[model samples]
Target: MPWINDAFWQQLAIGIAGGLLGIIGALLAAQLSSRGKPKKELSYDLRIERALPEIGKELAPHVAIRYKDRPVPALYVVTCKVENTGNTVVKGQQIRFDLTPAHPVLETYFAPKPEPEWEIEELPETEETPGPNYRFGHLAPGRKITIKIILAAPEEPKVEVRDFNPTEHVPVLPRTSTARANVQVRARIAVALLLALLVIPQAFYALGSVGDIAAPVVQLGLVAALAPFAPSLIRALVHLLFRPAPRINLDRGIVMYDGEIRGVINFSGEPADVPDSAQTLE
Candidate 1:
């Protein structure tokens, strides 16, 4: 009967409620801060997806695709993709693709359409400027426009961006298809909300509204609930900050991190182990 007293039940409730409320509070705080400052990462990629001459290699110069009764020689089908790979929305960005050396471009098509109020202008080649500039405006976060071009030139188009600053220089990985990120974003928000609801009582008590005796019990209960997640959180921070970065040494033709080589290698005419003294790129 002593264990079943009103005080005992009260403590139990307070402890459980407090732990939950604390977790909620912490998650909410983190979510707010994670919104982060304004950042812009404009990533541009140019790839020749296909190159079919249609004619023999000796007569390849005559390969052509007709556009409205006009014969346009087809050398390659190049895809130019521009993506806003940053968190904050970037506006008024000027992206220019220059096709130099007087190449013949038959068509420029915008795949998947584009975001609203976007414009693409054609800058004709002048006596002063040799290349034709295709200028685009206003692309938002996670939105990308892929321009597919039917061309009659061997050289790739040069890309230039203006009126925006890149947050960082992150090298774009080569992929046959675009990789989608930040999936199911709503799930994270939902978890944060659920955690906040659990710690409401502790929040009120800590705000100086609850009794002296109940305060410590509630606080401890909340701390106990959140304790299990501490290790994983710490581990994540550690891995993010101190993780080793591996690089491929082209000269030695090996993959290594901090002078330590990883995995096996197959060099056609070279030896199994490259001399460490042969070259050191640190």
Candidate 2:
């Protein structure tokens, strides 16, 4: 009964007020730090050139051209040249490149392909012309591979190359679509970590002042609830901010040119006038 005196009640009230204030302070710090220091925007330079019209016939054998596995209104070819430009005996290094078309075209070309296991549905006609085939394997350091991609004109075509370093799952440069997503996700993670640092100490302090175990339990519960969602929240934000491109699935078959010079090719078949021209894009 003596321990339940007015002094004891006053102390308990003070502790509760302190705990609430501590939580608010911690949350504010987290939010401010999470905003992060402003940074200068990075600029990436990319260049695409149209393949020169003429090349020596002898060079044609070295240059390989193939239709993209998809159909298109215009005729396009992708050419690659690999050379060991370095004097060192380069080995074990592989070269990979991905070309993403510009906005409307990319959206159209990358329309998601149907899932095969799902209910059968008629496939949509491919609206993309053939381009050079993609290659994966090691290339020497001094070696350079030039890919020539030709497509039937829909105004002008732009291509971007994403390079993968030997040691990473993701490439160094962000593709136009994924860059903003990554930035938002990183910010969310930073915020979550900062919050954890601030909340944990205050939580321990509250637990010590009052032998009440519930204080610590509630603090831990808040952390647990917020931790897993940080990543998902960032992803959702990206989805809301920028709509991703549609997926396109391509089937094997030649979209033969029927000599008409101006029409869509749907069936798979060999391309007419398979050029033996020696034109290197390197």
Candidate 3:
């Protein structure tokens, strides 16, 4: 019988062993290849100068100031330096800076400015006279740029330079106390949609296999997905449909607080405060 042939059985056993060895060798080779590949390290530094006050209402083309000593009220100038140490060219957008009060006491007591004003200027004319306000648009590999900030301390106040940005600065949104609620509603809607997609498919499959009624399951799933998203979607639709252009009140000043002293501060131009809806998500 075929099953009783020793030579055939020996050949089968050898084939199986060879296949197993081949698989094991392939796995080892893959592991070795992965291990031999070196991870790339990023080589670029984009530091933003501390946000400082502009001299006046007249838009100054360059330079900004941040207060270092609030009690003595001394001005501190933070210079931002961007260096492209990597091998590739780096491109960036406008540079934005903000000075926020450090502590809760300062938030209540001191008068601080809202989001810092933005100065969009052309890039520096020469390497020697690199402009401070203007963003470095492109930096060739191994190139570096610097920006200077001049700080003016409040009268006999304690000041500290807290934060700066060029990379992924916090988004300044239109401020409304109800903004947080809107964000929460949006998030809930998104979650409900995801759940509907997952659960409805499983329910439909089960019902189909059992030959049971599936119409109710499908309807309920659709409703569940639509319920939470409906309100926000409707609001958006109305805004789009009516074309009632939203007005931005540029006159209002956003309040900022000092870290060392507790007080409300004012910025020159109207800066939108964080939306309340966003705060709720946090």
Candidate 4:
């Protein structure tokens, strides 16, 4: 039998630490879909449906935008998706959307064409709130509503939820960059491959007739060898397939075009990660 050097033991220790972190990541992902009754929360996601430059160089060539014969700036469409992520039903009085900058709303409608009963009222700006607020009706558990707003503002407006005794708001966040994701995938493959190299032969030795170790020790060794390898392989697939896409920071503002997010600019004009390729839209 070949024994590993102390250096190998140190490397194994690092792998063990990494395995623990992978377990933690799995647990946090599970919480996103949890419908625990004890919690009171609303989850929201924003997507830019349409964005075009009103004063871009390309539009300067005899192109005019008018609605009903009246000139208008290039309209920006944004969809705000609010979901009742808790087990308890949420009433109309408990939730509202607080929008910023008091942007002029040209058209407000629901996607998929809603029923007559589905209605929301926009409250006028108040002394306390700098912008307008949209009040919604009752929302049942696991129910969601997607409201599309056509804004006259040059960019998408930031939205905030209020007045609900809500504990938290879950927003979609950016995922790993392409370069980072490739590195992670390769690392996972290497770990799983190396673990298989050790596990398969040990498993064969435990089951084969030439095995000299006691049955109980062999069984324990098999369990120890298989535990780390399974999760490492499974996490590789999860990271590859279900990794969240890079999303706009709704608190600042979203700038998207042709179903692709160009950049998310904040009040300070500082932008977050903007992709240099077609993947930037994601």
Query: Worst 10-residue stretch by lDDT in candidate 3?
Result: 102-111
User: What lDDT is reached at residue 41 by model 4?
Assistant: 42
Error of 2 at 102 (Å): 12
- For model 4, residues 1-282, the per-residue Cα lDDT tens digits are 256777666655554444444334333333332322354345666665446655678756678776556556566676777666545655553344456766666776666654445455556656675443555555566776677777666566676655533343432222233334334544454454445445544543554332322233434444454454456456666766886666433333354434334556455655566454533333
Put the candidates in lDDT order, highest first: 1, 4, 2, 3
Scored by Cα lDDT, where does model 1 land? 0.54
RMSD of each: 9.7, 20.6, 19.3, 14.9
**In terms of lDDT, which candidate is stronger, 1 or 2?**
1
lDDT (C-alpha, whole model) for all candidates: 0.54, 0.43, 0.39, 0.52
The candidate that achieves the highest TM-score relative to the unseen native structure: 1
Local error of candidate 3 at 38, Å? 26
lDDT per residue (tens digit) for residues 41-100 in model 3: 112222332233435546543534323333323344444443443344444444433333
| Better model by TM-score: candidate 1 vs candidate 3 | 1
Among residues 3 or more apart in sequence or in different chains, the pairs in candidate 1 whose N, CA or C atoms overlap within 3 Å are 19-222, 20-198, 20-199, 21-198, 21-199, 22-199, 24-195, 24-196
lDDT against true structure, model 2 = 0.43
Question: What is the lDDT, from 0 to 100, of the residue 272 in candidate 4?
Answer: 65
Q: Top lDDT: which candidate number?
A: 1
Q: Between candidates 1 and 3, which one is better according to lDDT?
A: 1
